[model samples]
Target: MSNTTGAERLRKRAQATALAVILSVAATSSLPSTNEGSKDMQNTGTTSPNASENLTDRQQAIVPIAAFAATGDIANLNTSLDHGLDAGITVTEAKEILVQVYAYAGFPRSLNALAELMKVLDMRKQRGIQDAAGRLPGSPIPTGDALLAAGTANQTRLSGGPVKGALLEFAPAIDVYLKTHLFGDIFERDNLDWQSRELATVSMLSALSGVDSQLQAHMRISMNVGLTANQLRQLGQVLADRVDGNVARRAQEALDRQLAIAPGP
Candidate 1:
């Protein structure tokens, strides 16, 4: 009987030990996990308004390249060109961006920027970097009346309606040039899409002072081409990050003014 009683006591002790182990496991499970805390910290640390909507590496590289080219900062332009190529901007696209510089920054700056691109290419070639030559215009550009008609249509579509203003009325020749040459001849080239063209234009304008009116107009055109206001804000962020405070401030101000006049959906 004493042996049986001792056996029962041992069984009871085993049960009590098991219960204590189960309670310890329950208490441990009830406490917050370190991994969950780590996840929360990671999310909070990386979260930002523009984090998801930030510009791509190629687009970010274009910002400083265009800005420096517009402002005639050849040294910085050279560096940006190298960075742009490294970021996957093709040789043809780089040429196109610099070529379009003339429309806003003037012929001298455009020519200089193109020349700098040539130098950049030559150096890269020496270093055994065979940069991709992007595709040319897919279709033939029209001429004469056909060209004018196509350009006017492009301009109208880009402006979101008929672009009528005192400035165009005062200088009708400028209007023709804009429709035919700028929008028609250049824009007709399909190798570079309209979105990239507008991005280059806005970057150029943002780099220059006293062109807020044009800058603001392009900001609207930027939206008309399906670039979001958030993207433009991202552009400003790129400018601030890659270029300088003043250039970024100009872009942000122009964007703010444009959005104030027409809030994006």
Candidate 2:
């Protein structure tokens, strides 16, 4: 081949190899999002009782529990724990969720969130106030292929159906990585648990404007995780009341839809 042709071919091969490496690393990093987005449920501007009433003090605890655990907002997260502790969520549960989301959300958020939790824990200690404590053995889920399969099953449960993830088609191996890493490694950990994790996932998604599809899917999964409809209704309403400006409208809207489906206790 001519020198120009030979050089161009070599460049293409190098580019392909580089692409493969980058993709492989990404696969190992986090859970992949689905291409089909969650649809925004119709907004109804209601919670349960007032659907309009502000979250009661006890119910309000979910705010920080949801926020810190959801967005990794360190400051807000800390505040949430203090709020939860005062409201009775227990320091141990708050810390566990923060540590657990590291699996679903990522280390950066998880670590920052945990630091905030420790700070709160310290403050509580100084005052001789302790929230409910729980045990964390470190190893909750199994390792290797079993982990991957279990995570996939968990992810599917959250989605309410099978997820033929898109990233895999774009790059085949990535599918395996998500199943192994995001689904397997993280989901396997029992500390955060699936239901609570999805609650955080939905609340965090509500904080964000877009990603409506993912939010809805997680909402569906949240139900699957055993959250009562009233609790879900309470969740959105609390978000609307507390995290106003950006999420208020969306929160109110999500609450409305959930109220419809929520069972009457």
Candidate 3:
């Protein structure tokens, strides 16, 4: 009896010790390690300082659409158009973006892109997808001298001041055309905002080679029109994800150059 009692006591003690060890292990596992705790603190504090400024779905849709249109990549443009429309870009807004492509990518590319848009719309309609037709220009475009004045004002505002240079001096007619037609005629259309226009311009410029200077200039103009550097960085990411890496690299480099010259406040 004494031996049996002793053995029973030993068994109970061993079971109790086992239970205690299991509880201790569970408690230790529940709490984070020291390194893990520090990492958690850093992540919670500074993982994304500007997360709110990231580009919207609609804005990101514009990057690939514009880049594909500029490079005459009709197949990718088709996909981007479908995505953009699905992302809440109205029919008129899409049209306006393609129309603006001519100013940078030339008439043929613009025309082809517009035709592709038409096809996309038709196909979507057949599939019972009713896309919204966005609004038109709310005001009339200026004419003659008024047009020139308006364009000049716009150029000054967009360029951040009166634009004077040897290029303008040597090509006086081009200057007049730029002020009168491109700025006045195209920019005066209030349906699309300047920020969107600059987004399209930057994307279009980024896709084309031998236009590094223009791309960099538009990067500055993009900032002047209220696009944040974080948003532009997001643009580059969109290009990389949806468009092409080379295109994104060009855009990022242009943005970097602009930021180096004029860091945002």
Candidate 4:
């Protein structure tokens, strides 16, 4: 009888200890989970998806600057440059955009726009408006076969497929030049992102009269690289207000045609 009584007491004690351990574990587990949930909520509150979708202040300023640069409008370039600096765009970035303009608008316009920028900077300095000089390309450019390979990959991804057509076939050397120079050499610089480059390209094409096809194509590329249709519309408005009605009208027409062909997400 005594043995039976002692065994019953021992079992009761073990059961109580087991219950205590389970309760302790449940309590600790819930606290960390609650804390993690709170942390996630806090982090989510701090960011916005729309901010990434919309053009930044600097990008807004850049659109007009690019348009004016492509058109070789010295007076408008001066005004756009002032606005760009005020909007937090750096001197180096503005210069880079102008340099990239040569690939599309020809060297005459590019060099003239760059000279205009230098004058603007000099004038701004005389007035004591110090501007930030943005960072340059971070690494050395690739060469030879490596450059061609990288450019080919970049063109494939940006175009949503391998770039091939009759134009490239007719002049195979032009294809090599485009791949090795434009995509590989210019794009691989990495100082500017692809989206900005596309934006600048679109702006330049929009300013010119005979590049409707190129403008339409870049509108698609812009959308492919996360430029919303609405943002492109806003770009038209930028040209309208900052550039002129004629330039803005051409841009809008191009955008409308492109949208009709392939509506954006």
- The candidate that wins on lDDT is 3
lDDT of each: 0.70, 0.54, 0.72, 0.67
RMSD of each: 25.3, 13.9, 24.9, 21.8
Stretches of candidate 4 exceeding 4 Å from the true structure: 1-53, 263-265
For candidate 4, the per-residue lDDT at 96 reads: 75
**Model 1 accuracy (lDDT, Cα):** 0.70
Q: How many clashes (backbone N, Cα, C below 3 Å) per candidate?
A: 0, 8, 0, 0
Error of 4 at 33 (Å): 36
TM-score of 4: 0.78
Residue-wise lDDT of candidate 2 within 94-205, one digit each (tens)?
6655665554456788788777778888888999986677534244566777877776665454444455534557886766765676656655544344444555566666
Model 1 compared with the native: what TM-score? 0.78
lDDT of 3 by residue, 174-255 (tens): 6787777776777677666666676788888889887776777777667665678899999999989988899999999988
Candidate 1, residues 1-265, lDDT tens digits: the string is 9989877865653343323222211000000011223223221211122244556787778788889998999999999999999998888888888888887778999999999999999999999999988766655778999889866766656555555555557777867777677767776766565556667778888898877666777776666655778989989988898888999999999889867656335
Worst 10 residues of 4 by lDDT: 25-34
Off by over 4 Å in 1: 1-52
User: In model 3, what is the error at residue 11, expressed in angstroms?
Assistant: 89
**Runs with alpha carbons beyond 4 Å of true place in candidate 3:** 1-52
- Comparing 1 with 2 on lDDT, the higher-scoring candidate is 1
